[model samples]
Target: MEQAESLALPALLAARAARNGDAVLFSDRKASWSGAQALEIAARRAGALAAHGVRRGDRVALLCTNRSEFMEIVLGCGWLGAVVVPINTASRGMQLEHILRNSGARLMVAETHLVGAVHAIDAQTHALESIWLIESGEGGETHNRSGAAAAGASVAGTPAAGAPAMREIAVWPLPPLGEPLAAPCIGDGDALAILYTSGTSGLSKGVICPHAQFYWWARLTAGHLGVVPGDVLYTCLPLFHTNALNAFFQALVSDAQLVADRRFSASGFFASLIETRATVTYVLGAMVPILLGRCASAQEQAHRVRIALAPGVPGHFQQEFTERSGIALLDGYGSTETNFVLGGGVADQRAGYMGKLVPGFDARVVDDNDREVPDGEAGELILRADTPFAFANGYFGMPEKTVEAWRNLWFHTGDRVVREASGYYRFVDRLKDAIRRRGENISSYEVEQVLLSHPAVETAAVYAVKSEFAEDEVMAALVLREGAALDALALIRYCEPRLPYFAVPRYLDFVADLPRTENGKIQKYKLRETGITTTAWDLETSGYRLRRT
Candidate 1:
């Protein structure tokens, strides 16, 4: 397979179009597009964005779910030299406001169903000047916002009474395609997207990814998965995530086809794979166990899927999953802020270990003071890229965080790992106060803040506990105020609107006091050690369900 002249999105699209214009490149529930058609769609989307005052270097926020428009907006922004900020569809309350404010996005394109989130955000709190709402199954016309009403575009209803009157920002149907804009001279280092990642001790930070990081991500990932031309690559992960986004690049760089579903459905997973003729697929560690738990069916063995980029799978389940489904799971390590830095081909992986460091990237197991630790000793895994623009530039609009994470000339992963004498790395635990549940990164500090907001709660300590699915579960230890009474269910109810459904603590413990240090700082490690005591309130057994909107 040949590579593009450069790693820029425009160059990649142009080269792919030139090589095989008629070959299908992308498909979702909305539509499918070939290489040339995809480029043309991107050009037209760029024209529409430019007509709405989105210029080069300006940020455009996307709050839609998995759809062709998601890819269109992303590719359009890249082609036009603008930056796209893809917000998590589940984002709400303080997190949503912070992203909109921090990104400084003047124009937002969101699904109509999720427009309530925008209405909930006070216009004064965000930089949005306009919102283009996309209705279900309908891709808006190619006209400007001014002409949208006349073109029969549906206008969004006014905000509900008592809600902030967001009259300052205009609401229009998804704009029509404008005149096709030509690609500019984009470089490998140009910002492609800003993906927000949860911070350990603070709010989430936007990771400024350049063109080359994804270029290397796709090239290396495709090689590791052994993707060949004409192979069908399918993923059910959300498009806002780096994994699914990088899958698109894998198809673009190699002459393969990409099939992205709206979301992962455990029941229909194998059916969809068979229908899409997928030869390669992706799954999270949590997903593997769910699939294995289901009763054996013919569909599991009927698919042609030979390999899956399955990360975080329990070591013991690896062989069981392959034996049941005939698809080998390849365990690897990568993050939104980094590329495919570790992992290898299917034939070269240890059961539970993250594969050895990939070539072109440097990895070190270091102590807390940044000193290198000997093999078999657990330490923070820090990494550096050998190639230029192969990792994220840094956190956008936050220089202090950028320096802190990228200090000492290495990007700190904040993950604890131990390297074996043979060079394989075993995962230990997270050094940062972040929790991973259902593939979503939850900030423990943010959860603690929410718990503390309740008037009855005087102190709160939020941390992670092991879930049955081999992922982290949010657990909170709370201290009530004097003469105050609050049940765990009531606190969860208070948190439902204030936090994402997943961030709400599944296990809550009401204590007289929390463990603290001499300086009065909370010692979270001690709390993590005594996870889910018998007296703790368990939401799973409480019969109350969280509404995942």
Candidate 2:
């Protein structure tokens, strides 16, 4: 345990399996697994990938929710020294296609419910060779139309030149075990995964996370959360994000139990905590405030959860949540591209301020020209690591972007923060066109691009409106073509299939023209300040439901 400095993921997993092979590592409502059992099972999956021609450094796309198989697939890919590309399951149409093509994923493993989205994709464009389906255990027919098949049916890949003979193989309905193969020599700096984060400039960029970065994330966070052996780390956040993945590794570092579900349910949050007897967990964005706002239940003060790692909870809500739920909330600051950079415990944390910069990171707040702003003045937050591999290597496959981001020897966060004279950083606003709804980071640029693709829209300006929850809601103001008329519901229907549910504009305004600067730049800040106009189309009140089909 003392020799943790040089260890990477595979080395860590191998050590744990040897140390406590039969010990319980996962204990959720659905199933349970021992460390040894998980290792052996995931090893077979590694062989399966190798058998299918996947090799070290190969990209394997994963479209999964919060299933145990998600972790297994990560482990399997790590065993083969392959880089896993964990895409957001809510991603549909071009958003999904962009990640597929950008990552150049050779193979993809998706849940049965999500396979349709992938099935509709033009595989050749993404260079996808094959796909394996994970049966959802919910009784339903596979989406393949060419033949009637059972759970393990094989469907042809979308026809295109240079595309592999694509087969939708249902190879994961049940866990398969095979002989464990020798793992390749992988180092701490080796790339573990490529996670696509919403770019402020509107394009999604892949953040390359190295294994050592993950190791430090786990170690540092475990120390912060006071995780101990036999403690239960309950999480329901999707595994695609760095937040949940950090908690995942924290459980491993502490040799604690993990209870995870596919997603968060505000109503069921307390009951699940009691069910798993969770000691520590995570609550991001709207979760803590929403839970505090929920109708009081008999189970509110009855759960075993003692501490919750709340990244950005409002101070008032943090106090209220503790008084109501008997759970303490701790605030911290980090992003997909960085680990826990600044944070403190409940006692040290002040309301409305991000804690001081943590060890292993050098932090600064700088103006546009990379000059450090005076304390108490708003500026962009930037960071440099004191330890190697503590942050992402770069945005994957984006050399110019990488150079731009690391310019002036610091990673520009594009987040406006003010370093108070007291040294606590206060988040002011985002300096980019992005929206955070619930737990999802949505690119306003991407949403605008989708809206412009519609025949009726001549120009679109997308921005964030304040949500009842702590996060923001997406709003779009559109300039319709001359004599063009698009119904709100019709536009909603168009977006349902193309954009993720969160990215779909909840409020739309058809305007004659958007406010522009002298340089003809659409002044989104003006629209954002104006917020939902009286004449704007309100999708929620209009009874327009998201259609999955």
Candidate 3:
């Protein structure tokens, strides 16, 4: 395996395309493009962007779905030495405005249906210079003139008939320009991406992932996942996420074919797997439960999938999934701030551990003071990679956040964990999500894991809420399996013998569904918001009480 420093992403991709021209590289539900064809598309898109005055280091905001166009824009930006800012589809007026303004994007490429929203926000933003609709039509042709005005300008009356509107630019579909613009002239230290955090903490911050950081992650993940030429890497996670882009790089660097989807679909996942002949896929924990809920068939077991890199897998379902699907599922632990810090490799596939830290990376459990905690004790998981390669440059445009996260020269992950005797790390919970009651630290992840083991429980999120006693208390929001129902008392009884008195949730709220991030991680922050004031259930006297089975 080649080291991260020795490889440039674009060069590696070009080399692969040259060798495997005819291999299928990307596929959606409608069409598939060969490696050679995909590269050509990227080249053309890059040329088109350049033609539109997009230069090296320019920020291009991509607000589109999970399609070939998204990949083209990303790769094309790489080829042009431009930074790609992928906006979440879920973002609306203000959120979209914040990202576009903060990124200092010169141009935006959005889908036709979303043009109205963009136009609504574009009037208040000054940094956006142009807008291109991916699905343009006669109505969408006037997008530029459709806006109220530039920032601080007022719109008085309706637009005059036949007045000139925003120029509708054609989608440039050509091969990359001459010499691929010298690899965008970036060093290992240059910022490559400005990925906005999902804003679970109330304010979204752009994480500055530099070239060397991304390269390091891509190289290690590709090697760890055993990506190779002619293999089809399936990606259904949104390209806006580090997971998708990281997997994209893994496939690109290894000369492997890529099959992308607009989004992960429980109904369409197996079909897409067979359609694309995908050899490897990255699955989130939320996706696993969704797939498990679907009825199993022999067809699902017949797909070409060999490996499933599913992160955040709870303890009980790990074995069940492997037994049923005949696919090896490896759970890893990582965050957007830290790319692929710890993962189970081909050599080691433990049941409930996130494997040991990778070479050149150091992991330790630390206390609030940043002192190393003794092994086997749960504490904050702090990790740092060797030198400047594996670590990110900093949070983009936020000096305070960057300094806070990188305190003492180590990135504080905010996740709590305990190191086992076998060198494996067991995830306990997030430090903020941990429950503190009467001076005892309770892991929400541990409680949720135990709750998931209950045959009736489909999903669970445990968090802390202010109690009437003026301290925090353990509260649980649960989703029961289809056709299964247990009252609140029944659940408490079920957990009585399984958990310690302090760990058992005093309050329980049953919901039809839980909110999730685009990558399928449970939005515990949302649950915490709704769960804090919820008086739906009473432990001492409630209609929904669980009885011993």
Model 2: which residue pairs collide? Answer: 21-36, 157-166
Model 1 is weakest, by summed lDDT over 10 consecutive residues, at 142-151
TM-score (all chains, Cα) for each model: 0.94, 0.94, 0.72
Query: Model 2, which residues run further than 4 Å from truth?
Result: 1-5, 142-175
Q: Which stretches of candidate 1 lie over 4 Å from their true place?
A: 1-3, 137-167
Q: Kindly list the per-residue Cα lDDT of model 2 for residues 475-524, writing each as its tens digit.
A: 89999999999988898888888898878999999999999999999988
- Name the lDDT of candidate 3: 0.70
Against the correct fold, how does model 2 do in TM-score?
0.94
- Over all chains combined, what TM-score does candidate 3 have? 0.72
Q: Across residues 1-549, which tens digit of lDDT does each residue of candidate 1 receive?
A: 233568899889989999988999999956999999988988999999998889999999998888888898998999899999999887877788889999999888888666566666566777787788777543333223323333133333234457764446677778878899998899899999999989576899999999999999999999999999999999999989999999999999898999999889999999999999999999999999899899999999999999999989999999999999999898899999998888999888999899999988899999989999999999999999988899999999999999999999999999999999999999999899999998889988788878888999999998999988989899898899999999789999999877878899999988988889999999999999988888889999999999876
Number of clashing residue pairs, candidate 3? 15
Tens-digit lDDT track for model 3 on 1-549? Answer: 246433444665567677777776666656677767767766667777887798888888887777767777887787677888887655543455667777888677776544455554434353675666565342444544665233223232222355544333233222234333345555666666788763223345677776666776777787678777777888888788788878777766677766778767788888888887889987876566667778997757878888888776665777777777777787777666776778747677687788887777888899999998888999989888775756777777689988988899888887889998788899876666556553234567667867898899999988887654324578888899999988777777777644545566878888898899998899887866775554457674554443211
RMSD of each: 3.8, 2.8, 12.3
Q: For model 1, what is the error of residue 310's alpha carbon versus the real structure, in angstroms, after optimal superposition?
A: 0.6
